[model samples]
Target: MIKCIAIDDEFLALEIIENYVSKCPFLELAGTFSSPLEALPLLNECGCDLLLLDINMPEVNGMDFLSAIPNPPLVVLTTAYPQFALAGFEAGVVDYLVKPFSFERFLKAIQKAQSRLAPRPAGGTGYLFVRSAHRMIRVDLDDILMLEGKKDYVAVHTQTQVIDTLTTLTAFQDKLPVKDFVRVHRSFIVALNKINTIERNVIYMGDKKVPVGEMFREDLLRRIG
Candidate 1:
C-alpha cells in the first residue's frame, strides 16, 4: 500500500479525502491534519508515500509547506484556485485536483503516485460495519440504497432493511465508499448506482425522493453524470 497523509484546514475537505482513501485498497491513510504546521513532525518522520496537501491554509500555505520538506513524497495538491496549478506542477507535484473533485479525478492522481511509488494490488470487500442497537451491523455496499440522518442516528436503507444506526450522518458517511455514496442533502446520502433517476433537483430511488442540498447539487450532478 502507498501510505498517505492529508492536510487541509477545511474539516469537510479532510473528511472527503478520508472517505476517498478508504475506497482505494492500495492507498493507506497514514494521517490527516487540520494545520500544515502540525504535520511538520510527521513529515519529518518520513512514514508516508504520498501527501494530499491543500493549497489555501493558515499558518503556512501549500507551496511553503512543500518547500519546507526535503525530498518530499509524491504530492497531489488539492485547491479551489486554478492559478496555483502551474506553481504546484513547477514545484513537482504528481497531480493537482481542484475543489469538489470527483473520485475518478482523484484516481488519476493516485495513478501518478503509483507510477512513481508502488504498483497497486487487488481491491477489498464490499461491506462495512455500523453500530446499531449497541451492536455492530455488517452492511453490504451493494445493499445500501440510501442513508437518512436523524438527530443522533442514521437510517441505513438497504434493499431488504433499514437499520437505524447510532451515529451522525457525517460519521456514517466517512465509513462509506466515496465513489459510490454521496451526501445529496444534510439529511440524506444515496448510492449512485441505486438512484433510479433525478427529477428537477431531487433524486429518485424507487419509491423515495431525496432532496439535493444547494451546496451539494453540483457534486451530486457530477457523480451521476
Candidate 2:
C-alpha cells in the first residue's frame, strides 16, 4: 500500500481526498492537515511515500513547502487553479489534479503514483507483479522482450503486450537477473536471448531497433560472445 498524507486548506477538499483514498485498495491515508506547516512534523516522522498537496495554501503555499524539503516524497498537486500545473511538474510532482476532479480522475492520479511507488522486488523471482491502471499483473521473466524507460514509468515490453509500471529505470537496475537481461542503453534493457542482431551499435529485437550506449556496448559484446 502507498502511504500518503493530504494537505489542503479546504476542509471539504480534504474530506474528499480522504474518502477517495479510503476506497482505493492500495492507498493508506496517514494523515490530513489544513496547512503544510501543520503537516510538517508528521511528514518528517512518517516518511510517507506520496503527498496529496494543494498548491495555493494560505499558510505556506504548497510550492514553497515542497521546496523547503531536501528530499520530498512523490507529490500529486491538488488545486483548483490549472495555472499552477506547469510549476508543479517543474517541482517534480508526480501528478497534478485540478480541484473538483471526479473520483475517476483522482484515481488516475493515484495510478500514476502507483507506478512510481514500490514495485515487488524481482530478484530470484521467476515473475513480477506489475502495476497497471486497475490491477497488478503477473508477468513471466521469459515473456519479457525489453524494458523501455518512460520518464517516471517503465514500459515492460513482452512478446504480447507492454506493461507500464511505476519506477524509474535507474531504480529498477538491480531488479533483474544479470545473465538474461542487460542494459543496452540508458533507456533500454533487453533480454539477451530475444535480440536477433546487433549492427552498428543498435540491437534488433524482432522488429524493434534499440540503440546501444557506447559505455554499455563493450559489455554487450563480451556477453554475446
Candidate 3:
C-alpha cells in the first residue's frame, strides 16, 4: 500500500481526501492535518510515501513547507488556485489537483505519485528501451544531459549527442529515474550530474544554457543546491 498524508486547512477538503483514501485499496491514509505545520513533525519523525498538500495556508504555504523539508516525500498539490499548478510542479510535486476535483481525477494523480515512488530492483542500471521511429533505442541514465521538447517530439540531449524522437515529455518523463533526473521546465529535463551551474532562470550544462521555467525555478534550485 502507498502510505500518505493529507494537509488542507479546510475540514471539508480533508474529509473528501479521507473518503477517497478509504475507497482506494492501494492507498493507506497515515494521517490528516488541518494545518501544514502540524504535519511537519510527523513527516520528520516518520517518512511518508505521498503527501496531498494545499497551496494556500496560514503562516506557511505548501511550497514553503516543502522547501524547508530536507528530503520531502512525493507531493501532490491540492489547491483551489489553478495558477499555482506550475509553481507546484516546479517544486517537484508529483501531481496537481485543483479544489473540487472529482474522485477520478484524484485517483489519477495518486497513481502518478505511486509510479514515481515505486521501488526499483537493487543494483539496477536504470536503463530504458524506447522505440523511436520504429527503432529500439537503449538509453543510459548517466549519459543524458537533458531533454527538450520540439513540437510533438522530444530531443534527448546526452553527453555525446542529441537524439530527436516523437514522444511527449510526460511519456519520457515517466520512464526516467526520479532521483537522477528532474523536469526543470515544461520543455526540459536535465540530468542532475550534468548541471554545471544555475544562474537565475538558466541552468548551465558545460557551455550549454537551458532555460528554466518560472514555475520550475524553485525546484531546480533546491535540487542543485
lDDT of each: 0.81, 0.82, 0.83
Name the best candidate (by lDDT).
3
Q: Which segments of candidate 2 are over 4 A away from where they belong?
A: 124-225
Measure candidate 1: CA RMSD.
13.5
Candidate 3, 124-225: lDDT as tens digits: 756666667888788777778898988889988877877888887766776676777888888899888888888878888998999988866766677767
- Give one digit per residue, the lDDT tens place, for model 1 in 1-225: 888999999999999999999999988898999988898888887658889999899789988878767556768999999999867654546788999999999998887667555322348446878787778888878899999988888899998998998776755654565557777887898989889988888888999889987756765676667
Per-candidate TM vs. native? 0.52, 0.56, 0.75
For TM-score, the strongest prediction is: 3
Q: For each predicted model, how many residue pairs clash, with residues at least 3 apart or on different chains?
A: 0, 1, 0
Off by over 4 Å in 1: 119-225
Over the full model, what C-alpha lDDT does candidate 2 score relative to the true structure?
A: 0.82
Greater lDDT among 1 and 3 belongs to 3
The residue pairs that clash in candidate 1, if any, are none
| Residue 10 error, candidate 1, Å | 0.2
lDDT of 2 by residue, 147-225 (tens): 9999789999999999888887644544565567777787888999999988998998899999998856765786788
* Candidate 3 Cα deviation (angstroms), residue 120: 3.5
Sorting all predicted structures by lDDT, with the top scorer first, yields 3, 2, 1
